[model samples]
Target: MEFLARATGVVGGAVARLRRIGTPARQAIGANPQIPQARPQGIMTLKMPVAQGWTDGRLPICAPGLRVAAFAADLDHPRWIEVLPNGDVLVAESKERPAPPRTLMDRAAQATMRRVKAIGDSANRVTLLRDADGDGVAEIRTVFVQDQNQPFGMALIGDRFFLGNTDGIVAFRYEAGATSLAGQGQGLIGFKPHGHWTRSLIASPDGARLYAGVGSLTNIADQGMEAEEGRAAIWELDIATGKARIFASGLRNAVGMAWEPVRGTLWTVVNERDGLGDETPPDYLTQVRDGGFYGWPYSYWGKVVDDRVAQDPALVARAITPDYALGGHTASLGLCWMPAGTLPGFGDGMVIGQHGSWNRARLSGYKLIFVPFADGAPSGPPRDILTGFLSDDERIAYGRPVGVAIGPDRRSLLMADDVGDVIWRVSGA
Candidate 1:
């Protein structure tokens, strides 16, 4: 099975490259389907299939009560999405590094701090909107605030929106028509940024707990875990109190997180510690318990210790590997459990967006999969429900999914694609 998997990787890459070059190579491959396809296969097209719109084949369904809808589109580097109590979708429509809106919030003396210059780097403006009626779309929307560093996660409690940028977490008020930072900015997290910033987040089912994921401080921290370096970890804090702590530790990077509705368990799709050759470490999705330690700089996936952080024989015994491991280097990202009988083989399974492989020679991921999750836990091997997003052709992708949100209807799945710069709504067949 390992040999066959390797063969799959080899052939998949050749086929992808062959898809790039057009002509006799293509004809030869077309004549011999078993052989790898030719390069530059075809032009990748951007198409968004609306719920009832026409598509090439069977359409994916939302859970019976769920339906997909576009909250917003065409923004700059949008990363996070949060819906408020009054039916407003707040978007972290991020500005680029050295973000220009640094001084926008500096009007007050208290807001003027030297570190604000550091905060100035992420200044991605926030956008807030309302559907007014409970329609599955946004009607009246406007820019809410600015000056955040890679604002990728958000938590909203009474009268405040706690935004998570790479450097720290800041709070804002969610007035329906207000267009600026309404309250005094309070910094809740203090991490010196050396660029390991993929801060995705989720709240406890009850809106009381704000769970923030801080990626390793560096790409591969030279010092390692003692300092909370490159490994991934989750931080839990109270919205009202503004106090926070490291909830769990030693994750290479958990970019996607959600609180399972049924179990009230905090779960995350982790981007395992990388640089292990090509397919050495597997990414994972699992229930995260507070104070529990998962192997990071030390061991991984239950048994394969990284050997980077020299393991104390006793520490290896104590590490917690993932509950379910996706195939190695799959780049698993945004995830949403199947709403209902959305996908046949995967009834109420966990639906994950595999963002595709970047550094690997073989092309994997790029498909939305349904991993059998029963009673709030993983059951079996993941099933591919939304596949073929990347056509047989090479050249370009329509989009790379970043966020997956279940709708108010509770049946449709809403996916935000960063590459295509579009939000996709996939409903049940």
Candidate 2:
């Protein structure tokens, strides 16, 4: 079971990498007038290509390019990460506000909006990075808004930067050359926030479409499924037109997205349903089809049903479970693909931050894994690369990582640590 578990984790990781890796670096945006892929309404399947040099199951123990660094603020919840054209960073500090009053069952339902503020202040903050001199590292920058409330995810589109908060979206004129938010921003939407309130955003290569994640409205409730319960899915919006619609559903929580143009798919790393036993519901990584569903408050992993919502009548047949699944409740987040690397095993691979385990008695996660891809899709299984971040000796970890960006350097990597108040950098040494 352990080997099989690892195998599925590896495959799911790779498939996730294949689905969501998007960039115009490999090729220019000629705007192929292509329609969305035709997939069954509620079917979930793992897609990948045949393997070659990446067949053997081996990955770097330390993930080759990882180096931890400190941040300016005493960050309690550094939620989102974005890289600018210049050698700087934009990080959203989701304040760890005091827990709102709630009953036991309602505790798990808490979200970003429920809390008043996160860090010390009641307002959420946005901190920028500035190297000042050519020091190869960001030395200092300014905090754009020190009095904002719970800023979550954001994307850089042209001269304007779009950000997501607990309530809605905002835009700021970003001047990369001067390291500043140059102009006044406006609110885009006024959507209500919930427990799964981490709003990660994705924009088209041409910056036409904006994709954001809205987590489930309940902690696993059918009674709460009054049209809004599991609306915690991916939303597609025309940035120019402001038209928004649900792109996919059945995902309990998906805070990360990557686009794989080779196969033309959007993949996500999902934080699946909790409250099951230590190993009941497995987290997953798979291509999200348009209008696809993945069985929230009902089933999981395509077959293994969750007992929490077993008796609920609404969970009859609509919950489309996932394709490739990972270990139960690993809280998988940030997803990225390693373009063919200098190392033999890392050629065309994927890496996911296993954001550590919370419910399990015997702690799992607290590391990153590598998944191999072939023909621009996932091929073989995943293997542990950045392990030991959590101390198995005492089941203690100093950091919990969230956002991951390829970095300002073309070949470098960056990881945002919410618990450690730091943004780490990595590259091939």
Candidate 3:
């Protein structure tokens, strides 16, 4: 029995790889994608990608004519960043809060993540970095916000600054050139926490409203819709009144969001459900319409119903198709739009931080990609911006990128590598 089990395991691994990785990159992107559902979860033990931190004299690979410099290092799990108006960068050094493993499956999953070093003690602070001499490296580093819950996203509007803590959104008063916030922030609104802790924030062009992207409490609504109340949707809040309402719905894990420069539409990078083999449903980038449903649990990639989910047929019928697919299990967390002239060779487009994969036998993401926009929509295929996060053999990783932001100078791009604990600056060579 033991020998038979071992042989079966090896055969299952090979089959999973063949089913997951054969799709060409071109066929996996754009308005339409080739999504092939593999075996559902639990048939095989989930594969956990190993994390091999950067060795001596190593850096990420950059595109030709582009260079990467270490903007800041020695951070405790830096996951998100914001560029201030004065060209200062705010880095959120945070991790997920520890909760009791409620089920056997959850405990097993936690063990796997701990082995991969995916979970760290919550840093609960935001650090500031400033390149005063116009160089790529930041000479000044200070604690901007500290002693908070696991903070993720940040935004600033005039004198009022907003920070998204795991359970609530907080407001702070700001002064130009100040390194740190003076006191504890006032909580503006509270939401459900624990599941999908990253709450990404962005403000409107006119600064009249603030938007927060809150991910679902569980994958595929496994805990039922009751547990997902006020989750898996973007909330639009009035800056003055502090009132909030859902802007969009059915996005499983919308981690990063930005406004398209030309069309002024809100776009988001979503991490879709897993367990349906590797290539079934592609994680996507889409223009989020108000009150729009992108089909979570019930269906995916428009109207392809997921047999695993019990749903109201009515909900699947209303499911809107995403604009573009970013590949399966990529965990595309960071999204930013680059204005013209920010970098040479790279014209107007969006920069994404793919934090890499963990479900499939083969690894995906773990690099920065640029999707060029022709008239406010993603046009050409995604171009490699900075790679080499994985080892030459692709079995281990040097780091995983989580958040991306264009520097306030409008020339450099800042990437937060959570596992490597370094912030990389990308500029024209």
Clashes of each: 31, 19, 0
TM-score-best of 1 and 2: 2
Please give the RMSD to the true structure for each candidate, in Å. 11.7, 12.3, 3.4
lDDT of 2: 0.60
Task: Report the error of model 3 at residue 411, Å.
Answer: 1.2
Candidate 3 clashing pairs, residues 3+ apart or interchain? none
Residue 191 lDDT in candidate 2: 57
Model 2: ten consecutive residues of lowest lDDT: 23-32
Instruction: Quote the RMSD, in angstroms, for model 3.
Output: 3.4
**Per-residue alpha-carbon lDDT of model 1 for 1-429, expressed as tens digits?**
334333443544464454434312211011011212212112211111111111343232344433444456565555556656555566676522422222322122112211111122343667775667755566677877665666777776667667877677777665654545664467777654434565776777777888877777433454554566423678888776777788988777777786566786878887765444333456778789888777776667655565555666665677886777675456787766555555333466667877665433344566666676667877666665555445444333444456666654555566655544445566654
Model 3 C-alpha lDDT per residue in residues 204-316, reported as the tens digit of each score: 99999999999998878888899999998999999978889999998998989999978889999999988875666789999999999989878999888888778779888
Worst 10 residues of 3 by lDDT: 1-10
